[model samples]
Target: MSRDLFRQAAKERQTLFNAWLMLNNPLALELAGEAGWDCVTLDQQHGAGGNETLLACLTAAKAAGLPAIVRVANNDPGLVGRALDAGAQGIMCPLINNVEEAEAFVRAVKYPPRGLRSWGPYRAKIGYSGDYFTEANDFTIACPQVETKGALDQLDEILSLEGVDMVCFGPNDLSVALTGRLDIWAKEVQEAMTEVLKKAREKSVMTLIFCNDADFAKPRIEEGWDIVAVGTDAGWLSSAAEATRAAVSPGS
Candidate 1:
C-alpha cells in the first residue's frame, strides 16, 4: 500500500500540519499540497461538498501525494464507507458523542472482524495498496471528532477502541458543547480541550487541534497535539482578499 502520510506521521510521533479545504475546490487542494501542508481535508460537513466534489478533492490530493481526509457530516457508517471507496485516505466523522458512536465510526472505516465495513473499496486503493482488499484495510485511518459533553465523559472508552486511529478535537463544536460558544480560547472551552488532550495522551492516541491563526498553533504543538490544522481554504482566501482590498482602499 502507498504509505499514508498522516499515518506515518502519527506512527513516527511526528506532528502533522493539516489544512482544511471547505471550498471543495480541487485546485485549492492541489495548491495546499503544493504549499507544503502535510495533509488536507475536504470539509464536507460545512464545505457545500458532496460525494462528487470530495472525490475530485481526493484525486487532487492523490496527485499531489498528500492524504485526503474527508470530514463527514455525521457518524454515518454508509457515508464513511462511501468516502473510503471514493479514495479518501482518512475520514473525520463529527459529533461523535460516545464510545458507541466512536466504534460506529470505526465500523464505517475499517474492514470486517475489525468492524463490518462492507466489501467495497472500489478501485481507490488498487494502485496505492497493490492488493486492494487486504492492504487497504491496514492502511486506512479512521478519525472521529470528540466535540460534546457525552464524548468528553466517555473519552477513555472511545480511545480504547482499536479501530479508531485518531481523535480530532473540534474546538468550535467543543466550545459550543461546553458553553454554547465557538470561541476556542474561552476558559470553559480551554478546560474541555485540555481534558480531551489529556485523555488521548493517556491512551497513547493521536489528537488533532484546529487553530485559527498561525501564531496560535505553537502552544498546541508544545502541548503535544499530534495534528494541528491551521484554519481553512476559505479562511486563507478570504484573508488574502481582505488584505488586497484594504491595500487599495482609502486607508492606503
Candidate 2:
C-alpha cells in the first residue's frame, strides 16, 4: 500500500489513533506496530530519538505495515529533508508560529513548483514502490504544529496555506501560552483548542493533537480531531512501573 492510506483516512473523516514512539528500541517499536496503532510519530523533539535511530524505526515500521511521521526537533529544511529521505511518510514541524515559518515548513516538504525540497530518497525508496517523486507530494503528510499564542494569532493564515495537510496541536506549550502553566485542561486552553478545531474543520484542514492518555485523547477525537496521538512508550513504561511499585510498596 502507498503512504496515502493515512491521507485517505483523514479525508474520509476517520479518527486515527497514533502512538508516540519515544524509545529507540527496535523491539519496542515492533511491539507498538503489532499492538494495532494506526500510525506513529517518531518523537525527536523531546524524546531521545535521533537520525540513525529514527531511520531504523522507520524501516521497522515499514516492515510492520505502519505509516510513520517524524516530529522534528525544529523546523529546519535539512532536518525535514533528512527525515523524509530516511523514509518517514511525513513530518510534523514544531514551533510553526507564523506565515513565514508555515511557508518554510511546506517548502521543505514538497518538490519544485510546490516547494524547494531537493531530490534524494535512497533510504526511503527501499521500502516504497512506484513513483516517489510525484506521488510523494500527495502521500506525505505536512502537519505544522499550532502551538504558542503567536501561532494561534495567525491561525487562519497558517491554516489556509497550501501543502498544510494538517495542524497538530501541542497543548503543553499551548496551555502555557494561554495560561502560565502546563495544564492542558485549563479553560483557556480548551477554548483555544476548540477554536482551532472549529476553524480547521471549516477550512477543510485535518487536525492532530498530543495528549498524555486515552482520557485526554478520547475527548479530542470526539472533539473531531483527525488524529489523536497519545503517550510515548517510554512514558507509559515509566508510569506503569511507578504505579506497580507504589501499589505493592510498604507505604500502601
Candidate 3:
C-alpha cells in the first residue's frame, strides 16, 4: 500500500503530529497536508460536513502526499466502512463506551476473519498496492474516542479488545463528564487522563490527544501520547483573523 506512515510511526514509537479539519474546505485541507503534518483528520462528528465533503478533502490530502483520516459521527459500522471505502486510511469513532462498541468499530474497518467489513475498496485501491484487499487490514487504523465518564470507566476493557489499534482522548467532553465544566486542565480531568494514558501504554495500544496548541500538547507528549492533534483548521483561521483585526484596530 501507500506505506501506512501513521502505523509505521506508531510502530517506531514516534509522536505523530496531526491536523484536524472542521471547515469542510478542500483547499484548507490541502494546505494543512502540505504544511508538514503527519496526518490530517476530517471531523464528521462535530464538523460541518458529511461523506461527500470528506471524500473531496481526502483527495486533496492525498494529492499533497498526506494520509487522511475520518472521525465518523458515531460508532456505526456502516459509517466506518463508508469512510474506508472512500479512501480514508483511518477512522476515529466517538463516544465508545464499552468493549462491544470498540470491537464493532474495529470490525467495521477490517475485512472478514479479522472483521466484518463488506468488500468495497472502490477508491481505496487507486494509489495503494495491487494487493490492497489482502493487506488493507494491517494498513487501516481503528481508533475509538474515550470521551465520557462511562467510557473512562471501561477504558482498560476497550483498549484490550483485539483490533483496537489506538485510543484517543476528547478532553472537552471528558471534562464536562468529569466535572460538569469545560476545563480540560481541571484536577479531576487530568487525573483521569493520566490513568487512561497509563493503562493504554500498559496494553501497548497507541494513544492520541486533542490539544489546542503545541504548548498544551507538549506535556502530554512527554507523558507518552503517540499522537497529538494540534488544532482544528477552523480554529486556526478564526484566530488569525482575530489577530489581524486586533493589529489593525488596536483601540477597538
Of the two candidates 2 and 3, the one with more favorable TM-score, higher being better, is 3
What is every candidate's alpha-carbon RMSD to the true fold?
1.5, 1.6, 1.5
Q: On residues 9-88, what C-alpha lDDT tens digit does candidate 1 reach at each position?
A: 76777888898888989888888888989888788899877888877888887788877788988888888888889888
Sorted on TM-score, best first, the list reads 3, 2, 1
**TM values, all candidates:** 0.94, 0.94, 0.95
Computed on alpha carbons, the lDDT of every model, listed in order, comes to: 0.83, 0.86, 0.86
Cα lDDT over the full model 2 = 0.86
Error (Å) of candidate 2 at residue 166 is: 1.0
- Candidate 3 lDDT at 186 equals 91
Q: In model 1, which residue pairs have backbone atoms overlapping below 3 Å? A: 1-129
- True lDDT of residue 38, candidate 2: 86
lDDT of each residue in 60-138, candidate 3, tens digit only: 8878887877999998888999989989988999988777778888889889898999998899888786598888888
Ten contiguous residues with the weakest lDDT in model 3:
1-10
